[model samples]
Target: MTAGSFLARLHGRTATGVPRWAVRVAYAISLTVLPSGLWRILSVDLRVPLMDAPTDGRPPPDWFGGEWWYVIGLSAVSETLAFLAVGLVCTWGEVWPRWIPWLRGRRVPILAAVIPAGVGATFNTLLWPYSMIMISLGRRVDGGGDLGLGTHGWQVFVFYASYWPLAAWGPLLGILTVHYYRRRKAAESVGVREDGARSPAVTVSH
Candidate 1:
């Protein structure tokens, strides 16, 4: 299969009226956090030392030992959350998968997906800009002195490059959420079932 066809299959079936571009955007949103997640795994969990150690004989942070699990867990959790955006443009978001216990084969409540995603999108939209401003002013978002990544060329470049894609995360999620809302609303208006069947509309007699 061609690359385009492969991606189409991989993305699964989208809800009726969801534009092709929206499906691609949802997939892209899911990948925005990946570089930073991988960077954390490499630097902390694997102890690759992407940042410099203190020169004054200070010991490494607790994350190097007892707290190492936190680094791995954070990366895993963040990636999983980002990946959920894929469901926004796919059938799985409209209907719960059969593997789910009580919710299996049931139509998913629209608000159940929209509220959390909308909240997340709003939070991220504000967060990354604040972080960039703080960093630009030579202040850490956590109120620390320096990030220990050094002020020189390659270190700074690598650090920013790893996380820069996060700036797009919020906007992309917001777009996907809007598209999801519109598509689901259209489906509901016509009494369209998850499998594309249209139920007869009931008319109320005056």
Candidate 2:
């Protein structure tokens, strides 16, 4: 394709640039994280293991500051991530939300999201290796526990069973991020810039 058309196509092709595999991965990861986020919010138990010391294959009883407080904190973080997932689907990632007041409905610069998301996806993909290291060798810096269910045979088993979901998340996000970038480059080749670039208009997906 000519440079102009190639760039022009970015606006439309962005949707496609995000591969089906990545889309499904984003959906799966977001879905799994959503329930976990909700559970973290509603549950009274924090169940977050303390990483004050190195793990001994068993969590320290007092690792979490406390069950309830820990749960609340964990819930907030999970919900934040869940909300961020909307960026993957919506142009809001390209603009500030109306609820945001002063910057409400303002266009988000591409650099803002791409730089972070691209880098984030890169590192996030690295998590697979980290996870493998944790399982095979162990962690060097103690911080927190993986979001496994509990310290029971079934709990561990289920943790493993569901854990595979996250593995898919990173690669999928990488694909999506790459797709977004290429599409953006193409859009630049054309004339369609983001909302704030010239006008304050916003475009919603059909």
Candidate 3:
């Protein structure tokens, strides 16, 4: 399906019945990462020196200013991963994609997605707050002093505004994950009850 149609299905416009807001939140998560990605891209592509020089007064690593590939690659990876959250509320999450030769159209075992996502959610949830706190304190969480972000006032504001959205990513992902789990469990329980009701009753012979 095209991306628009695929997104509609995830948003409860299709039969999946995932709440529209959940899909919106997933989309928001994707959007939230965009500004930061764009900023990084501009910094590297334009060679404008947007990021802070290191606090130690030593020259930054060669990769810092020279790595166009790193900037592009990192942005692509981050946004792509963020977009995956949309799958949680989509039908594709519960069924194998048609392109998969062996598992195509088969039911997805719920926990297969759940366990890894849950673990990731835990790490993600902890990450943003810590990072924000460190940023606010003007210290790198990795143990450095002020990054000397330079005197570009608007750039600093934009940088913080863009990056701050990331703080919501983990919490939103965790919420979506839980909602998916509960929805699948409820469906499974209904299926079990229906199956039980259809079974023939036992009878004893005298």
Most accurate candidate by lDDT: 1
Q: Give per-residue lDDT, candidate 3, residue 59.
A: 43
Q: Can you give the lDDT of residue 172 in candidate 3? A: 85
* Top model number, TM-score: 1
Give the winner by TM-score: 2 or 3. Answer: 3
Tell how far residue 146 is off in model 3, in angstroms. Answer: 2.2
TM-score of predicted structure 2: 0.59
lDDT values of the candidates? 0.78, 0.52, 0.72
| lDDT (10s digit) by residue, model 3, range 1-206 | 99878657554233255677877777887887788788778765665666655679854334345678888888999898888777787766777777889998788888987886787678877987788778766787786997455535676787788778888888888888898888778767655321123234458999
What C-alpha lDDT does candidate 3 achieve relative to the native structure? 0.72
Q: How well does each candidate superpose onto the true structure, as a TM-score?
A: 0.84, 0.59, 0.78
Judged by whole-model lDDT over C-alpha atoms, candidate 2 comes out at: 0.52
| Model 2 worst lDDT window (10 residues) | 8-17
* Candidate 1 global CA lDDT score: 0.78
